[model samples]
Target chain A: MATYPRDLQYTREHEWARIEDDVIRVGITAYAVEQLGDVTLVDMPAPGEDVQAHERFGDIESVKTVSELFAPVSGEVVDVNTDLESSPELVNEGPYEDGWLVTIRPSDQAELDGLMDAAKYEEYLGTLDG
Target chain B: MSEALRETSLTDEHRALGARLVPFAGWRMPVQYEGIKKEHEAVRTRAGLFDVSHMGEILVEGPQAVAAVDRLVTNDVSKLTTGKALYTACCNEQGHILDDLIVYRLEDEKVLVVCNASNRDKIVGHFAQNLSLGTPWNDVSDAWALLALQGPHALATMKDLGAPPSLLELPYFSVTRASLGGVDLWAARTGYTGEDGFEFFCASEDAVALWRALIEAGTCHGLQPVGLGARDTLRLEARLMLYGNDITEETHPLEAGLGWVVKLDAGDFIGRDALRAIKGAGLGRKLVGFEMTGRGIARHGYPIVANGEPVGEVTSGSPGPTVGRNIGLGYVPLALAKVGTTLGIEIRGKVVDAMVVRTPFYKR
Candidate 1:
């Protein structure tokens, strides 16, 4: 069973977003990490870059494959996790906490409503298993 | 799908340890236990056991076996002493590699040919049509089980299992008969992880007992069970060539950076003249390793470009757990195969900067 938080919104691609005021904390879901295996590299987006919702912001490289990291919502990247360049394994160690990828100030706050909630995300993951 | 794919003798053991099972080479093999990186690290630092029964094993014996096998393979089989293993590529008349295999000389008249599981039928058919004129060829793939106990602590684990006295004297690429827990076994001092280890060949019925015994014996030595996923990544990190991925029926051994295994002047064999012609004509492209300096990985079939011109395509690539970077192998033009050559890999329409690096992206 994967950990699913009720407080966060998720994209179909398995990225999670926690909205705080106008900024959203972005990271990959626990299920995503489990699917990707051990993460070796996380290419972070540059701060101040504008990223579109559901578009590729960066990539997460694992032992066997490389997966594109998508933005959960349309936003301007305000902060990028610089710590991941040297310790990419942190994503696998603490996916929901210390492994947060970026902080984004959404271009439109209404985008959060369009994303899936905790229950829906879990259901989505179940569908993926089949 | 085929009972979730056939389980190995250690399948239950892997699940007991919380392993992630995945399909590999037509078997339900464990892809990881704790994780690929951790399991790989355990093998490098201590020891790791691998269930490799999916590898095909064919037994060739009889009086005409020597000459028959020699003419079928690229390497000189006559020079092999009993209990010695030689790695070589079996090629067709066109000099293209059919499959890479390990030929174990068990006796003057008996030989064991280990080939990739996916190519088992093809290889056996090749032998039947080409070399089994009067020799007895037995496809023992279903009757035998193969296990690889690899890494630095492999010797200690073998000692704990009451390995034969001949084991201590076994050098690299050597095989010896040994008794473990009263079961007769063939132990070969060879592995794919670029570490010191042994491969055990035994009856399928005794596989579970031997695996359990080895695990029990290796517990104190930090030996862990590894899977096919890590097996591939580890071998790639060591610059070891995989048959289907790195070299195929359309690829020559020399083009795949395996020229050392091709002994041209030895004797008459299949593809000898073609290989000699390629040697004299000079290779157009050669396989080389590359490290990604930009975002994304260089995956298989990804185009390699140098100075805006396409040079080759990546044959293998992954984020190396041990090396902490995206590394890959590809066939590039001869001029661009040199170390430190700058190139680019096209991934999803984006060209990522890469540099040709020396082989074995990870070093112990």
Candidate 2:
């Protein structure tokens, strides 16, 4: 069974968002990391770049395949995880704590309500199994 | 399409250990146990076990066995002594490759030929047609099971299992019969991982027992059961040629960078004349390795470009486990195949910079 934190919001594409004041911490879900075996490389967006919600922001390359990282909330990228360049496996090791991908300051705080909660995301994943 | 996927003798054992099963070459095989990189590291640093029964084996025995096999393969089979194995390719009359196989000379009159499982029927049909004039051939793939024990610590693991001293002295590409845990078996010092390892051949019924015995013996030395996903990554890291991916019917040995394996000066074989001509005229495009210099991953069928013109396409690509970088193999013009040449790979409508590098992308 996959674990989901009740405090975080999730997107349909398996990205997680945790809002802190005006900034939001984003990373991939545990299910996403399990799907992509071992991570080898991470392509991060620039710190100053503006990204749209549900749009491709970067790429994550695993030993078996490559997957695009999508932004869970619309915001300006304030900071990108530079540690992932040399230690990409951390995403697989700690998807919630140390594996955070980026911090973004959303233009509107109301966008958080549009994302799915833990219970809803778990239910969404159940539909995919069938 | 509803036909059930074939299972190896170790299928239940693999599932018991929590392996992810996937369909490979029409068989339900393990893709990974813990993880590909972790299992690959275990094989590089320690030892790893592999269930390789999916490979096909054929038996050839008769008065004209040597002559019959020599006419069908590209290698000099007549020079092989007993208990020796030679890697070679079988070609058609039109100089196209049928399949690459390993020929084991068990005795002066008997030989064992191992081929890819997907091409078993085709190879058997070709053998029957070409060697029908003499030599009796039979398919023995169903009766035998193949297992690989590979790594740097393989010898120690074998010794711990009470293997005979003679087994330790077997040189590379040599085979000998030995007993392990009271079971008689044929052990060959051959492998595809470019490491010092042994391949064990035994009866199909005895496979599960042998696997359990080895795993029990290897427990203290960090031996784990590996899957086909790690097998492919390891072979690619060693730059070993895979038939359907690196070499195919449309590609010749020379073009696939396997010219050293072809013995053209040793007299006439099936494709000797065409290979001789190819050797003399030189090759046009050659297989080469490359590492990504940009952000994106290069995948199979991605267009390769040099100086704004398309040169070739990637045949195999992945983010290598050991190298910690994106690497791939592709066919490029002969001149650009040299190491350090800059190239480009188109990824998602954008060109990503790449550079040609020497193969065996990862070295321990």
Each candidate's number of clashing pairs is 0, 0
Query: Tens digit of lDDT per residue, candidate 2, span B1-364?
Result: 5678899888999999889888888899999999999899889999999999989998899867877887888888888898899899888765668899888887788888989988888999998888847578899888889999999888989999998899988888988778886667788898888678999988989999899999999978999999888898888888887778777788888888777768887746888888888778888999999999887678888999998999999888877767766788999999999899999999877899989998888765
Write down the lDDT of every candidate, Cα atoms only: 0.88, 0.87
lDDT of 2 by residue, A6-109 (tens): 99999999999998887999999998988888888788789989998889998887887789999887889998888998888899989988899999999777
User: Which clashing pairs does model 2 show?
Assistant: none
Models, CA RMSD each: 2.2, 2.4
Who wins the TM-score comparison?
Answer: 1
Number of the top lDDT candidate: 1
Q: Model 2 - which docking category?
A: medium
**lDDT at position A24, candidate 2:** 95
